[model samples]
Target: MTAGGDVGGHPVGPDVAEAAVPRPGPVRRFLLRRPGLVDAAVVTVFTGWALLLGLGADSMYWLHEVLGGPRVLLMQVTSAVLTLAGAVALVWRRRRPVLVAAVMTVLGVLSLALTGATNGFELGVALALYVVATTAPPRTLLAAAGASVLALLVGARVLPLARTVGAKSLGVDPDDADAFAAVTGSGPFGFATSPAWFAMAAPVVVLALLAVGLGTLVHARRQRVAALAEAARARAEEHAQRTRLAQASERAQIAREMHDVVAHSISVMVALGGGASAAFDWAPDRARAALDELVDTGRAALGDMRRILGVLHDDDGDGPAGDAPLEPQPGSLDLPRLVGRARTAGLAVRTSGLAVTGLDALDPALQLAVYRIVQESLTNTLRHAPVATDVEVDVRRRADAVEVVVTDRGGTAPATAGPGSRRGLVGMTERAAAFGGTVEAGPYGQGWRVRALLPWNEGDA
Candidate 1:
């Protein structure tokens, strides 16, 4: 909303936000650049010729006398004035094209009837019809053009021939009998060899059709331009929508990483800290060892936390990751360290078949799923199974799957951190599910059990 051109909370560039209007095509740009000047120029073209032709028409005295009216300038001057007035309507042709065209047609008919001659207002009518054609729909354009042609033909051909015959029957003076003939002889409008109805009708129809044809062609080009503009806008909006979805998915991934790193590390440190404090009174040596273990646990947690956070600082891929320490993806190689951490936190863990062959042939994504499942299961045992003395971690590789099972003997333990949020379990299940795997977790006798199956193709394995 600022003068600097901001739209919908985004700072649009100066080149883009010029007036916040839709971009203009060639025809529209011309009219929009100087609308008043364009209107004035159109009015001048029509009005200038109309006024000139009005001045050259038969004298008012001759026209009224020959048409069997009074020998005054009443009808002649009136027709001239009406024709000039219709010419002024050309200025507004673009804004009210059909209305202006209808008005001009009516004025043309009146002028022909009053003096039995055109005052060059047909040119103005033709221009108005062109405007109407450019703006009106196909059906409307057809109707308006048809009506205009019929009215002009009646005014120029049928009405004049009838008026002349009436004037002759009324015994008009012989000297003024050729009024209609003289009017159509030659003037600003092209000359007609004969004043007969058919002679006049042909020109009237041709002019009207020509105007409509030009208008229709312009409208077709304008429509094509408008359609292309609409398509471009749709593509831009789609791309923006895709970018929003990508950002949302990335944020969710960051939340999962933070939870996994913080929960496991913090749980083990708290248990070590508690044990050290409890033994300081009676067993000084034991307390010292516990404190030392607590320190070591804190350092390891800090290192893991740093590794997890290093991903947030974008590296730009030039070389170093902003000088932040790099870390490898956790996998089967880290299983021994993981188990050691749980043992340090006072959990007795037993492993079987930890060195499964062909484990290295697994895809990184599948390996990641396996590692997170085991880590989350061990963290759950440490937090919820304090009374559990034996924790078993079993790894087995079959022809088409890698299976992991973690179980504790005594699942019942006094709660140290109230209730669980259950996000850990959800994260584990989600990771396994990403690679078409499944996890089943529930109670097994007095202890809890978590079993995971990550399927793999033989070619991939």
Candidate 2:
């Protein structure tokens, strides 16, 4: 009945992935969280076994026979104590690799000198050597490894050779070194010896070098994987930053377009409303005509607003286009209508060099910039220069660029505040500069003039 698929008040699932996953116990969770604890546990267990075997069966009897009845018990007790202490010391090997390795090695050498057996301590020494190789710096690791090799050589080779000489001095047959009675039958030092020195020493050397080599390889592999993971993380962050910047830029562009469209349309409508109110009493016919033009301009502006919003709402266009008609965004071709709307608002608009002779050579974005710059300049002229009777709109094509200039004479009235204050100039500049163009807007010889020069790249059209 629950979301996890509990049936008959008991949890059950047929999904193998869910069923196979069982909750971990507290101890298991603890070990999983701290991997070093698991490694320490394993090392402790192995070392403990080595200690027990080496002391109990491998070397205790030989040591007892060699030391004499009076001192045999003391030597046996001492050997067991030291061997146990050294095995326990391996628990802290990872925390202080070099120091632990040295401590364990010294303990191992003392044990071998006392009992001539190193099975349990040998495992601890090997583990310490591996830890040093993986965690310590190069010089420290080399020093630890060298000490371990020396301990193995001395314990396995030198100690056995010394025992052989002891047996000969006690009048035992050196040739029959493996015989149990050879040394015991002649004197106090006794017991069957282990294999020849070379035979016993080779395996220890191989195992020590092998542990160090494996630890080095594991360290190298971990470092390589960490570097790769860091690189991947950095790249992912960079890509996310780029995506954010692009989204912010897109939102800003949308805001500027909406501002241009609404401000221009409303400015024209406001001017017409004033004109219509003035003519209503003296010329009713002219007032009706102005009202009609206002209505048309408002409708066109509404349509353009819908088109812009449609690109956001149904970007993929799977819905009906009649609701929010999807149309090509207006570019240079829409400038004529813009000029006409300005003229209808009663300003005496004159033009020269309005021909688009080289428009086919410009990119779509550059053409859009040209259209928007002209549109904003005209809107500014209408709002700020209401007393001016003459306005000039000009477009000229040069060798590498197309220039647009809008000039308006000063009016009798001073400038008044307008919607989207100063943003019109900023938007114009942004649009022009996006295509590697330049914009200049300021006073020009008793009139305000706005000029923009956009590069014409014929190959990119």
What are the per-model C-alpha RMSD values against the true structure? 7.3, 9.8
lDDT of 2: 0.71
Candidate 1: tens digits of C-alpha lDDT, residues 155-274? 765564334532333434434737645534434342344344444466567778788899999888778766755554554454455555656766766677677777887878777777
How does each model score on lDDT? 0.72, 0.71
Clashing pairs in 2: 50-120, 51-120
Pairs clashing in candidate 1? none
Q: Quote the positional error of residue 413 for candidate 2 in Å.
A: 2.3
TM-score to true structure, per model:
0.78, 0.77
Deviating ranges (above 4 Å) for candidate 1: 1-30, 57-80, 117-120, 161-199, 281-313, 316-321, 458-461
- Residue 223's lDDT in candidate 2: 70
Q: Single out the weakest 10-residue window by summed lDDT for candidate 2.
A: 183-192
